[model samples]
Target: MLAILYVSHGSRVAEGVRQANHFLKQCMDQINVPIQQICYLELVRPDIQEGISRCIKHGADCVIVQPILLLSAGHDKRDIPDEIEKARAVYPNVRFIYGRPFGVDDSIIDILVERIHEKHSGSVQNDSILIVGRGSSDLETPRAFSRICAMLAKRGISPVSVCYMAAAKPLLKEGLELAVEQGPGKVYIVPYLLFSGILMRTIRKSIETSVNRFSFVLCKPLGYHPSLIHLLRKRIRESIDYDRLSAQS
Candidate 1:
């Protein structure tokens, strides 16, 4: 009667979509729900409508829609809720509970520290870290991102800075320039991205032209991790519990 639908902002790149699917599949064993499904917001198969339909077909009475995103941006806010409204028109009786994304958790910063260590493990004190964010118009996006950056900074990773891919101040070029100005050390460019896509490629292309190739290390995006799977499991549990409490009250 309960279903967990994991929603990701899909990509034009097949490998990006594949990576999202593979990551959710990894969650199957760890999470216990009657019916679990994966869907995308755009540029991929099994869009949100179809995902909801499938849950109904499988006899789910209460569906927990979980956004598999790093931040609580437009997709998690306006877009997905809009789609859920359509489903509501069709399934007035079925309960739908929307859940949160990872959203600037401390554990996420730990993964980021590990990512930085993948390349610049030697002397974080000297390393200047640049975090590349997928920007959002929602004011909360940058605020939350800044908090993540601040958390990373408190780790004593000197001069940890950030920039947006679009729709915000200090774009990638500026971020790289600032990091370069930090002076005389390896700058690890950390993409606060979950999967590989046009954004990742864009970051790579910018690095190739804008900076000395040898002086900077392009660290891997925060992709599939066992820890993330556990986090999603927590999200599902908390969502369901809150809904139950709300109904009782």
Candidate 2:
């Protein structure tokens, strides 16, 4: 039997962990697979090895490990894969397949649009968008972030800019300054994050401080939206197909 193991970058905040669990439950309902489990990368219970062990215990012959991350950063490239390698050594007989992380997808753009609509009542063209991401040291993630900004601009969201919370150039403060300089009627701060955590709190604090200087609205983090659920399901199905094709060849 094929089992699905959804892994997220866990948070220390209780609400963040709760949000992840809640999102996983929603995903479990939509996914067709019967054997599914969720675990965290760090700062939470039932880490990667334990998640895999549970799947094995449940008689899953092959396990599909899906990363619930927004970008292909260190976690996607090193940490998660290293954990899976360790698990493979422990359970030599169980087959493991890794899925790709979310990378500049249209559905993500849709989520950002939805967030904008939910938070702001004014016209989009008149407002500037400042998209914030949990910055990465990897060059690819920042490139992907730039792509997202370009995509938004193509969709007629004028004067859109992207910045990072950490590990990259043009941090959130700088991005906000650029947005303010645009002289738009209002500036919307969009967080390109999966769940609420310390980053979200920090973004909120930054916005609060800047509100006196310019019109700023902080949209909620990209939580368990239906679009995200669909994207994750698609990744899992694609991974399963790839695994089966590899096995046959």
Candidate 3:
């Protein structure tokens, strides 16, 4: 059996656990193959270490560490790899595979497009789409949103802007103000969040109370979508296959 450790950008908020557990269960249902375990990175129970131990105990010949992050930032580039290394040392016999992030993948684009269409289906030209993410100071973090902007531009979507919620300049309200200044007939705000919690609720309320003529719709987060599962499966499968090839060599 194979163990898929879906590592998330853990949050202390209780909602984070509920969201992660929900997605993991959905993934379990989608994938018929035996899964050794599912785990988080931090700020919650069943950290990566414990998840790996469970996988080992469950007889995982090879373990795939899949990051549930959107981009290759500090956590993806540094923290996750470090944890995987430690896990590998702990389970010497089991081959440990690290998966790539969900970066500019087709599935992601599909989700974005769906969100835009869903929110502004009939009247797209007037409304500007704002792609908002949990802001990061890391340079790589902004690049992810930039890529999304580029994708939207290519699709001929006008008046689209990118902004962060924290740790970056031009926060959500500022971004909305810019969108208004840009003279978009209507403004649509999309939360680039993985799950709903206090932050999401606050943002939604802010949009609803202060704004007029601007329609703000909260498209659901990437919740147990088949494409996400496919991305995970591909990453895990590649790692396992590569290890097999290397062993044969």
Candidate 4:
């Protein structure tokens, strides 16, 4: 039997964990797979190792580990793979396949646009958008973020800018400053994050501190959206199909 393991970058905030669990539960209901489990990369229980063990106990001969991440960063590339390797050592017979993260897709762009529209009901043509991402040291992640920003711009949201919370250049403050300089009627801070956490809180606090200088509106993190649920379902299906094809070949 094939067991799907969904892994998320766990957050310390209680609401973050709640949101993750809630979202995963929604995915579980939509997925036809009977054997599935949820795990966290850090700051939560049922780590990767435990998740793998649970799969084994549940009679999962083939395990598909899917990272519910926005980009292919260290956690998706190294940390989760390393944990899976350790699981492999323990269960040599069980087949394991890793899946890719959500890397610059139309659904993500749609979600961002939806978020922007929800926050700012006024004319976007006159507003400057500041997209905030959970920064990564990986070059590809920033590039993907830039692509999303560009895509947003193509949709008529003028002067769209990208920023990172950490690990990359053009941090949140810098992006906000640039947005302010554009002198838009309003600046929208759209967090390109999956869940709420310290970073989201920090964004709010930072904007509050600079509220005197410019008008800013902070959109909620992209959490538990239907588009995201659809994206996760697609990833899980692709992983299962790829593994089946490999076996047939």
Candidate 1 lDDT over residue span 1-249, tens digit each: 989888988988889888888889988777778799998998887999999999999999899999999988788888999999999999999999999998778788889989988886577766688889988788998798778878876887667888899988789888888888888887899998988789999999999997476777899999876679878888888998988898899
Model 3 sits at a Cα RMSD from the real structure of: 2.5
Write down the lDDT that model 2 would get.
Answer: 0.86
CA error at residue 128 for candidate 1, angstroms:
0.4
Clash list (residue pairs), candidate 1: none
Q: On residues 1-249, what C-alpha lDDT tens digit does candidate 3 reach at each position?
A: 677777876777887777777776776676545764667777776888988888878888877788888777778888888988887787777887787877777677777777777766775776677777888789987777787788777777766788778888788778766767766376767777777766777678767776552545556655446677777666666766777787799
For model 2, how does the per-residue alpha-carbon lDDT over 138-178 read when each residue is reduced to its tens digit?
Answer: 98977897788888777777678888999997998888887
lDDT string for model 4 (48-157, tens) is 89998898899999999999888888998889999989988999999999988877889988888888889887777777888898888998887887788788878877
Greater-TM-score candidate between 3 and 4? 4
TM-score of 3: 0.86
- Candidate 4 structure lDDT: 0.86
All candidates' lDDT scores? Answer: 0.87, 0.86, 0.74, 0.86
| Per-candidate total of colliding backbone pairs | 0, 0, 0, 0
Better of 2 and 3 by TM-score: 2
Model 2 error, position 189 (Å): 0.4
Candidate 3 clash figure, as a count: 0
- Per-residue error at 52 for model 2, in Å? 0.9
Against the hidden reference, what TM-scores do the models get? 0.96, 0.94, 0.86, 0.96
